[model samples]
Structure formats: C-alpha cells, structure tokens
Target chain A: MAYSPAVQELMEALRCLPGVGPKSAQRMTFSLLQHDRSAAGRLARALQTAADSVGECRLCRNLTEADLCPLCASGRRDPGLLCVVENPSDVQALEDATDYGGLYFVLKGRLSPLDGIGPGELGLESLEARLAAGEVGEIILAVSPTVEGEATAQYIAGMAADAGVDIARIAHGVPLGGDLDYVDAGTLSHAFAGRARYR
Target chain B: MAYSPAVQELMEALRCLPGVGPKSAQRMTFSLLQHDRSAAGRLARALQTAADSVGECRLCRNLTEADLCPLCASGRRDPGLLCVVENPSDVQALEDATDYGGLYFVLKGRLSPLDGIGPGELGLESLEARLAAGEVGEIILAVSPTVEGEATAQYIAGMAADAGVDIARIAHGVPLGGDLDYVDAGTLSHAFAGRARYR
Candidate 1:
C-alpha cells in the first residue's frame, strides 16, 4: 500500500510550517508515526492551542497567553524604554542579548505599500497613543536592515520627532539584508547596548 | 509591552513543527498575526483533521485515510510486483517517478536493535504471507543505503530467499551518507530505473 490520504493530508498540513517543504513534511510525518505518536498528537494540539489562545499583546503586540504580555505587566522591566521591532522574533533576538531591560513594541509588519501593508495596518496609531501617554521615555528602533525596514524606521522616527520623545535606533552591526533571527545573540546584544540616537 | 503570554505560548507550540526552531517559530507566529487570522485558524483545523483521520494501512503500514491506501486499492497497480520500503516517504518518491506500476509494502521503520526494533516489529510475518499466497511474483527492495537500512534490506532478502520469490534491491546512485529526501527527483527516478538484483 502507498501512503494513505489521511497521511498525505497530514504531510501537506505539516508543510504549512515555515521551512518545511513537501519532502521534509513527509519524512517528519512518517518519523512521527514510527517513533512518537504522542509527539505528533502534541504537535497537532499545540498548533490548535496556540492558534486559539494566542493574541497580540494589547500594548506591544507581542505574542502572549494572557491579555497583557509579561513585559507589559511586569513592573521590574524598564517601562520608560520602548524597543520597537518589525516582528516578534526580533523581540526574542533582543531579549537573548540580555542587555536591554526595556519592554518591546512589535510592529507586526513593515510599511510595504506595494504589498498593501501601511502604517494603519502595522498599528502605528497604537504606537502614537503609547508615545503620547508619556509612559515611555526612550524609543529604540530595532527593526531589520532591509529597505522596507529602513523606510518604516524613517517614517516612525519622523513621528517620534513630532512627538518630542527621546528616539534612538539600534546600531547597524548586522550586515545589510540580514535577518535579526540569523544574527548571533552576542552581536545583537552589543548592537542593543551601543544604539545611537535617531536623527 | 513585550509579546503577550498567549502569543508566546503559540510561538513555543509552533516550534514543534519540523525545522521550525525557536526563531522561525516566533517569526511565523508574528507573520501570521499580520493577515492570516483565518489561515491560522484553518491551519489549526487542518493539523487536527489530518492527525485524527490518518492511520496505517493494514496491509503495508503505509499512511491511509481509509482501510487501504490508494495504491493498494487501485486495480491498475501490479499486485504481482511488491516493492518493500523502509518508510512511507519512499513510497511517495516512487509514486512521483510515474515510471513503476507496482504495489508497495511499507515497513514503517528499519531494524535497529539498539532502538529495540526487530523483524517482528517490522511485520515480516505479513510479507511472508503475501509471498506464500503467490500473489506477488517480484519483490523489489527499496530500503535506504544507511547501515540500519542495509541491515534491514539484508534481513528482508533472507526472508525472500526462504520464500523463493524473485528479489531486487535499489542500487546506490544515492550519495553515501546522503538522505533520499535531499536527492533530486530525477536522480531518484534514474536510480530506480537502474536498480540491480541483490543476491
């Protein structure tokens, strides 16, 4: 017998995960069947649990199980410093550096008009509101170094300037076109520490 | 605020998918938030749907949505020719070739004594029964060239020898220490076409 339709369907579904193509999906599906039925079940359950339970933090747009993310709720974090990023993964990269005690503001996307993503789509209104509230003293732009990322940073910097907030952007230690996820934690941390003020 | 707890949990859960490390998982989680609320929901549904519906074929241990996989039920496939493989992925690889017209027997796993996998665990009894019934005239060994895979193929050959069935094994066009999943489809098809008889 060849692969069952159910198994094929499962393999196709597994391919939806990032970096998992058709072949890898098939290998993973069979491996799960051969060795760890429980792990496969857990993975399915986790996908559902995550999709159903997770939502953007009301404040920073970071992933969270609760209504308020830990960074937002925690009094110990430096609430005065706000680190703006393009995606949640960037936040993880920044946290790994352990240099910044500040909370994060995830843009969730960059300003790509061609792809139909604009400031409103990226929740810039919420960012503006957060800056107006005066709860944040320093704003650090920690987005990627891509052209779209640079454009988004410039747009946000202009907004921050109008708002009269102490605005800064992360240092450019990472190469152009590099993903924050691919950079080493040490270099990322150093970049965070040596951030320069945005002009 | 940093990512919310719910988002964090979802990202963590997504990491279980094949090749989805911590960084990619986080990126996917955030990227999904950008526009795929419905796609995410559909993905969650598909994961559970496939897991619950798929099971091993009773005949070959291949993945199936029904009692038997499509290849087993299809009258067009040559039941007289049985191709034995270590995993269901191998079946897909062969199917993609569109050259062979034989039925398949999926061992679902290889023999690894260290891992406590033996012949009985591989369902050799059913294979022997298929051959003894005289329904199968040719048995093609499509197992991999790895140490465990070779051992499993040799064991199958011995079993086929006792049954007095014509036997052939896939040749080693695959690079040593290379995975079949990584090989190109054309190479795999060529390898399949040029398979030699294993004594």
Candidate 2:
C-alpha cells in the first residue's frame, strides 16, 4: 500500500526548503517520525512560534522578534559606520569573520532587474531615510562580487553619494591563507589594482 | 547582538535529524523564516499529526496509522512468504526496487550486544508467535551484511529452523552497474562464489 496520508504530506511539505529534494525529504520525514517525537514536537512549536513572532526588524530589515534587531538596538555598535549586505545571513557571516563593530542594513536581495528585484523592492527608500538622518558617516557596501551583486552595490553607492555619505566596498583579493596559484585572475587583478604601499 | 531566542531554539531543534550539522541547520532555519512561513507551518503540523498518529503495525511492525500496515491488511500480498528486514525504511527500499509481493516484519534495529539490543528488543517473541501459527511457506532474511546484521540474521535463521520454515537470503554480489575494477575484494569474492551458470 501507499504511504500514510500524513507521511506523504510531511514529505511533500519538507521539499519546500532551499536544498531539500525528494530523497532528502523522505529520509527526513522517516527519521523524524521514527526517532524523536518530542524533538519533532519542539521543532513544530519552534516553527510556529518563530513564524508567528519573527518579522523584519524595523531599523535594519533583519529577521527579529522585536521592532529593532539586537545590533540595531545596541548602543555599543558604531552608528556612524553602517555595513550594508544582501541578506541577513550575510550579516551573520561578516560578524563571525570580522571584528567590525558597526550597524547594518539588510537588503534581503540583490538588485536583479530581469527578476523584478529593484531599488523600491529592496526598501532602498527606507535606507535613504536612514542615510538622510545624518547619523551614518561611512556606508560599507558588503554585497557579493557577482555581477548582480556588483550592480546592486553600484546602485547603493549612488544612493549613498546622493545622501552625502562616503561609501566603501569590501576588499576583493586572494582569501586569507589562500595559495597564489589557486587565486582566480579577477581577484588577483583587483588586488593588484587596489594594492597598499609597503613600509 | 545574538539571534532571537526563538530562532536559536529553532536552529537547535533542527540539529536532531541524522547527518544535519550546525551549518545546514542554520541555513534551513534562515530559509524557513525568510521565504515560506506557510510551508514551515505545514511541516510543523505534519510532524505533530504524524507523531500523534503513526505507530508500528501490530501484524508486521511496519509504520502505520492503523493496527495493521497496508501490506499486512492487503489480501494481494503473499502472507505465506514473509520478508524480515532491519528497519521500516528497508521495507520501502525493497518495495521500490523489487517485485517481492510478500508480507514483512520490521526489526527496527539489528542485534547489537554492545548496545544491549536483543531478541526481546526486536519483538522476536511476537514474530515467533506468527511463525508458530504455521505460515505456509518461505521466510526471507533481508538484513544488512554488517557484523551485527549477520548475527541477527543467523539468530533469526535458527528460530526459523526451529519452526520448520524454509528460509532464503537476498544474494550478495557486486552491485548491478558496478565497475569490477572498483569493486572491493570482499564483494568480488562473493560474486565469484555465487557465480551463475550460462545457458
């Protein structure tokens, strides 16, 4: 006979995740059903609670349960130095890898005109308002090095310029501890173009 | 600032699944929160419904919402020919790959003395009662080829012998579509030992 209706529905529902395919969804469904029912219940409740409460932070547009995210609310972070990223996860990635104690603005997406993602969709007007407040002195464009990311960065840079704020893009070069032979040509060229003077 | 408590809780709860590490869990958590809250809610509901309703079939020990699994309840399946497997997933695997229209017994786990698993833990007594009821024919041992699985199979074989039931095992050989050059020595030897006659 076929799988139970609930089991089939669970498997189908699990496929909505970013990377989960049919096989993974099936495996996850079976594993959760077989092994920890309590954990499953906790996951269900967690999803419900998070979904019901978590919304875009009013200040930075990052996922948060409150109006302002912790970074946005904290007085410790540098309000004058704002780092703009394509998504909330990028903010987390930068935080983990760097000691930059600055505030952030999450775009939630790159500017992709072909895909209908544009300035208005990314809440750029809100970002402009934040900039016009005159608190942020330097805006760091921390979008990815991809074509779409570069275009999005350029668009944000233009906005920052109009708002009379200085803008800087994060350095593109050989990764820390990377071998020269393995470094890509584009990155090496960028590194050469932006080289700092040796003592 | 740190992640919201509910977000943190959701990420932690997601790590309960097999093979899911911290990075995958974090990615999943963010994706769910950002993209599809309704799908996430459906997943949570499915988990709750499946956990509350799904249980082992009384007859075959396979997962079911009712007393008897579909295989056990169906008149089409051969009741006289029973296939025993280490877990319910194995039953699904066999069903997908083979035309074995027979009933099944799910052990849920193999015999592992180091972990204190034994005959009673596998519900072998109930299986024995089913065997003693004079199942008309053959029993198939479809356990894995691991040491614990072999030991479990042997134990079941002894039980079947005592019950005067004929038994067979799924063959061990180089897998179909496998390159012989990459086939391990143990599997190659099994293939040689089980060589078939040509017409």
Candidate 3:
C-alpha cells in the first residue's frame, strides 16, 4: 500500500535499525504517530545528540562522550587488573554478571585478517603500550572461543608474556544449571578435558 | 554499569520504541553511533518531520500528512464498497493479504465503555453521516472477535440496519492451514456454528 511521503520516509528510515524489516518499521511508525508524539520527538533529539557527541573512550575504546568512559574514569576500579573483551556490549555483559573489580580493554573486534580487521583496527598498539608501562599485575582474556577470538587472545597473551605480566582466561565449560544432555559434544569434551578436582 | 551521560540518555530514549528493552536499546544506540551515523541522522530527521506534520485523514481517520490519505484521495477505489476496520495497520494488513479494491472507514478502535472508549472516540458519527449519504452499498466489519469486538460490531450493525445498508462480519474460525488439534475449542465452536453449505 502507498503511504504518504512523510509516513513512507519514516518507515524507510526505521529500517536502518538491525532486525527491523518492512513490517516492523510500519508497526513502529504507526505506533509512534498514534500513541506518543512526545516520545517520537524525544527519540529524535536523543539520536541526533548522541550521534553528534558520542565517541570511543581514549583509554579503552568503550563508547563515551568524554575522553574516558565512566568505568575507566572511576577511581574505585583496580588499575592493576585489566579484562579484555571484543565489544562494548560484552563489557556491559561482564560488568552486570560478574563481580570482578578491574578495568577493561575493549578490542572492538577480534583478529580477522580476511575481513581486513587486523591489529591496527583493534587498537592493539595502544593496548601494548599500556602493558609495557609496567603498572598492570594481571590480564584477563574474556574474548569469545571462536577461531578469530582464539587467535586474538593468543596474540594478547604473547604481549603479556613479553611484558612479564600474569595472564589468565575466563573458563570454557557447561554453564551452571545447564542440562548435560543438552550440552553439545565439543563443549562437553572440552569441559571433560579441563575438569578440576572436587572441593 | 554507568555509561557516559550522552550514551545513557540515548539508550533510555530508545526504550520509547515498542518491544525495545534495556539490552536492545543499548544495542541500537551503539549501532547507530558506531556503524551508521548517517542512518541515525536520517532517522532523526524523518521522525521529527513526520511527528511535526502527520495528522488523521479527514474522511477515514487513517494517518496522513495531507487532507486525505492516498487511498481515500484516489478515484480508482470503489467508494460504494467501504470496508470498516479497527486501525490503519489493519488496513495495511488487508491490502497486503487480499485483493480487496475498495475504500475504507477506519474505526481506529472498538467500543469499550468500561475503558471510556465509545462511538465519539471511534469517529462513528462521521461514519454514520457517510452511510446516510447513500453511497456505501455494504459495510464489512473486520474488527476482532473478542468480547469488546463483538459489542463493537453489534453497535455498528445496529447503525447499518437503521440506515438500510447491508452489513456483514468477517469470518472467525480455525486459521487456514492450521491443525485441527491445535485449534482452541472456542474457535472450533465458533467455526462450527458459522458453517456454510458446500456444493
């Protein structure tokens, strides 16, 4: 059906969001027009303001309006311990789920040479410079277990070894409260091989 | 975790969208800021323009930026075959799913006196005036079949009877291609009661 130019343009622009297709964009357009004009205006202003001002934190590559992110700026977090993750969302996930009181180093993406994402794109040189400055006592690798993630983690581990800093990885295993029958064979085998002695 | 003021505000504002929660809001915000700044600007402009300009169609109460929506303004559709529906979205759904080439009168909502919705809210007076003008040959009730919907249909049918216009309700039953075992008993009973003769 042909909508008015304004409505049609709104629907088309809404599709730029991930997972939003034509149907969903139509629904969103009608919902905003019918229910909340104030909310629509607010969202528009917010999008414009954030797109203009938000940038990567200078220290960790996490998204922030200031030079450093709130987590990086906070004096409460330990500077001696650092956690490496692939995306800003991953940093948020780890912060919410874990009690680790260390700083984070966001890689932005894993090492994918075929995709043209190399050490430069991931800001690895900045990370190496920070490592060589000799303040960090331990480094934690929290990247995913995919092939690219493994390569990225090993490269960071090598840097840590050269800097004479301790390095450890987050565990890979069956999740707590997960049914063993539903676990995949590869994960099960990996868990079995890395089994620890009972308490 | 505390995000920078701009980032946090963007995430919060994104939750105004239907079905978007905190995690989804965060993802949308980051995606717009990081990957598609141009899309974010376009979306913001579109939202502001639509919200500032769009209003209901004078004849059908469907959303439009002009005096009438594209369908209502078109001379091709049969004005004598007006289909009554609950929302602009329903009009869209019918247009996509059926070959119905007719004008529409959008009720916008069903009758629900308990929640303070009545004929005045649904623009039924305008609908009645059109019926009295003696142009529409049939009134098709495409409202849902819930208790409120049934009450709404009955009220409109009463108006049709007084105006000497033919009235019919859309069929309710087990959906096409649906398994009989999976059909709810209420739908089955309704379908059985409304069965038609076969050739």
Count the clashes in each prediction. Answer: 13, 0, 0
What lDDT does each candidate get? 0.78, 0.87, 0.91
Task: Evaluate every candidate with DockQ and list the scores.
Answer: 0.43, 0.65, 0.71
Clashing pairs in 3: none
What tens-digit string does per-residue lDDT give for candidate 3 at B1-199? 6588888888998888888898789888878988999999999999999999999899999999999999999889999888889988899889888888988988878999998999999999999999999999999889999998899899999999999999988889989999999999999999999999998
Q: Which stretches of model 2 miss by more than 4 angstroms?
A: none
Sort all candidates by TM-score, best to worst. Answer: 2, 3, 1
Ranking, DockQ, top scorer first: 3, 2, 1
- Return the clash pairs for model 2, or none: none
**lDDT sort, best first:** 3, 2, 1
Per-residue error for B140 in candidate 2, Å, reads 0.9
User: Model 1, DockQ value?
Assistant: 0.43
Local accuracy of candidate 3 as per-residue lDDT tens digits, A102-135 = 9999998999999999999999999999999998
| Residue-by-residue lDDT tens digits, candidate 2, B158-198 | 99999999999999998989999999999899899999998
TM-score of chain B of each: 0.83, 0.94, 0.97
